[model samples]
Target: MTTKPDRFARWLPIAASLLLLAGCQAAKYRTLESFGIEKRDILGSRVEAARDAQDDAREQFSSALEQFRATVEFDGGDLEDLYDRLDREYTRSVDDAERVRDRIDSIRDVAEDLFDEWEDELDAYENANLRDRSAELLRDTRSRYGRMIVAMQRAEATMDPVLEAFEDQVLFLKHNLNARAIAALRSELDGIEDDTEALVEAMNASIAEADAFIQSLEGSS
Candidate 1:
C-alpha cells in the first residue's frame, strides 16, 4: 500500500486546478458583458440634443431682436412691455446656450471614454485572433461633432456681448427719437434710419452664420 504512487495520479490535482481557472475566466467574461450594458451609449444622442437646444435658443433670440426693432421703429403702444419681454427672452437664450454647452461637454467626456474602451477591446480581439467588430468605433466619428457644438457655443458666447450692445443702442435710439426729436431733425432722423437698417443687417448676418454653423454640426453628426 505504501508503494510508489503512479505519475498520472500525481498530476490529477494540477489538471483539476487548470480546469477550475478556465471556468472562472469564462464566468468573468460573462460578468463583463453585463457591466458594459450599464454604461449607456449616449454619444450620438447627446450631440444631436445639444444642437437642437442651441438652434432653439438662437431662433428665439433672433425673434426677440426682430420684435424689438419693429417696436422701436414704429412707436408701438406696448414698446416698454415688448422690450422687457425681449430682455427676458435674451436671458433665457443665454441660459439655454449654457445648457447646450454643458451637454456637449458631457458628450465629449463620454466619447473619450468610449474611444478608450474601443481601443482596449480592439487590442484584445486582435491578440486573441478575433475580428474587431464593435460599434464603439462610431464614437470617434461622432466625437468631432460634439467638438463642433462646443465651438459654436463659444462663438455664441462671444457674440452675446455684441448683441447686448446692439440691443442697448436700439433702446437708446427708441428713447431719444421721440415725436419731438423726430420733428426737430426730420431729415437727420430719416438718415438715421439707414444706420438702423445697417445694424439690423449685421445682426441678421450673425444669426444666419450661427444657424449655418449649427446646421453643419448636425449634418456631420
Candidate 2:
C-alpha cells in the first residue's frame, strides 16, 4: 500500500516543477515590464490570442465536420484516399483544439498574476482617495474578468465531446474502409454536425467576451 510519504514524494517533483515554472514566468513579466509592457497589456494580448485560437478551432471543427460529411456521401472515389482525408481532418481538429486550450491557459496564467500584483500593490498607496478609486477599478475589472473566463471555460468544455465523436468516426472508418463503413458513418454525421454547431456557438460567445474584456482593459488604460 502507498503511504502518505510515498504520495508526497511522488508529487514532490511535480510541485518543484510548478514552482520553477512560476519563477520563470515572473522573471519574464519583469523583463516585459522593464520594456514598459505591463501585465494588463499582456493579459489583453493573451485574450486576443485565445479568441483568435477559438475562432480557428471553430473553423477547423466545421471543416472536419464537412470532411466527415463528404466521407459519408462518397459515391465512387478512392476509398483509401477518403479515409486518409478524414484522418487528416481529425488530426487537424485535434491540433486546433490543443492550440485553443493552450491559449486559454496562457491567458489564465497572466490574468492571475496581474490580479495578484494589483491587489498587493494596493497596500502601497498612501493617498486614500487614489487607493479607494484603484480598489474600485480592480473590483470592476475582476468582475468582468470573472465573466469572460467563465464564458471561455464553457466553450473549452464543449470541445472534448465533439473531438471524441470525430475521433470515433475517423477510427471506425479507418478499420472498415469500404462502402459499408461509409454507410455506417452516415448515421453519426448529423450528431457530429449538431455537436460542432454547439461548439461553434459557445466559441463565438467566448470570443465576444474576450473582445469586450480587451476593450475594457484598453479603456481603463
Candidate 3:
C-alpha cells in the first residue's frame, strides 16, 4: 500500500500544474482583448481617411459641374470641345469618388466586425477593465476626423482656381453672345447658375459642419 504522504505530494504537483495552465489561459485572453482594441482603432482610421478622400472628390465634382454650367452660358472658341472636356473631367471625378466610397464601405464593414468581436470578448470577462483601451480607440477615431478636415481644406483650395476659371468662361460667353441670343438663353442659364450656386453653398456648409464635428471629437479625445 502507498504511504499517505507520498500520495499527497504527488497530488500537489498535479494541482500546481493545473493552476499554471489556468494563469496562462487568462494571459491569452488579455492578449486577445488588446488585439481587438488595436484592430478597431486601425480600421476606424482607414474609414475616416477614405471618407476624407471621398469628400475631396465630391468638392472637385461640384466645381466641375459649376464650370460646365458656366462654359455653357458663354460662347467659347469651341462649345463641342468645352463639352467634351467637361464630360471627361466629370467622369474622372465620379470614378474617383465612387472608388473612395467603396473603400470607405469596406473599412466600415471591418470596423463593425472588430467592434462585435471586442464586445464579445469583453462580455466574456467578469471584471473587464477597458478604460485605457477605450481611450486609445477614441484617439484613433479623432485622428481620422482630423484627416477629414485636412482633406476638406485641400478640396476647397483646389476648387477656388476651378471656380475662377469657370466664372471667367461665363463672363466671356456673356460678352460675345448677341443681345437677343443672350436673352433667349438667359432663362435656362439663370436656373442652372442658381442651382450651381446653391450646391456650392451647401458644400461649404457641409465642410463647416464637418470641421466643427472634428473639433469636438478632438476635444473629447
Best by TM-score: 2
Query: In candidate 2, what are the lDDT values of residues 1-221, reduced to their tens digit?
Result: 96433544465455545556555887766655554557786788788889999999999999998888888999997999999998999999999999999999999899999999999999999999999999999999999999999999999999998999988988887789889878977888778888998999999999999999988987887
Residue pairs clashing in model 1 are: none
Task: Rank all candidate structures by their lDDT, best first, as comma-separated numbers.
Answer: 2, 3, 1
Q: Which stretches of candidate 2 lie over 4 Å from their true place?
A: 1-23
lDDT, model 1: 0.49
lDDT of 3 by residue, 1-221 (tens): 85433443445445435546555634533443433324433443454455566566666666676656555565546655655565566556656555655665555555456556655565455543565576466566546555544544444444444444444444554455443443354455555455445545544654564555445544543
Candidate 1 local lDDT, 5-56, one digit each (tens): 2332344355435546555633533333333321122444455565566566
At residue 45, candidate 1 shows an lDDT of: 43
lDDT (C-alpha, whole model) for all candidates:
0.49, 0.86, 0.52
Give residue 85's lDDT in candidate 2 (0 to 100): 90
Better-scoring candidate (TM-score), 1 or 2: 2
Q: Which of the two, 1 or 3, has more lDDT?
A: 3
Q: For candidate 2, report its TM-score.
A: 0.88
- Clashes in candidate 1: how many? 0
Going through the candidates in the order shown, the clash numbers are 0, 0, 2
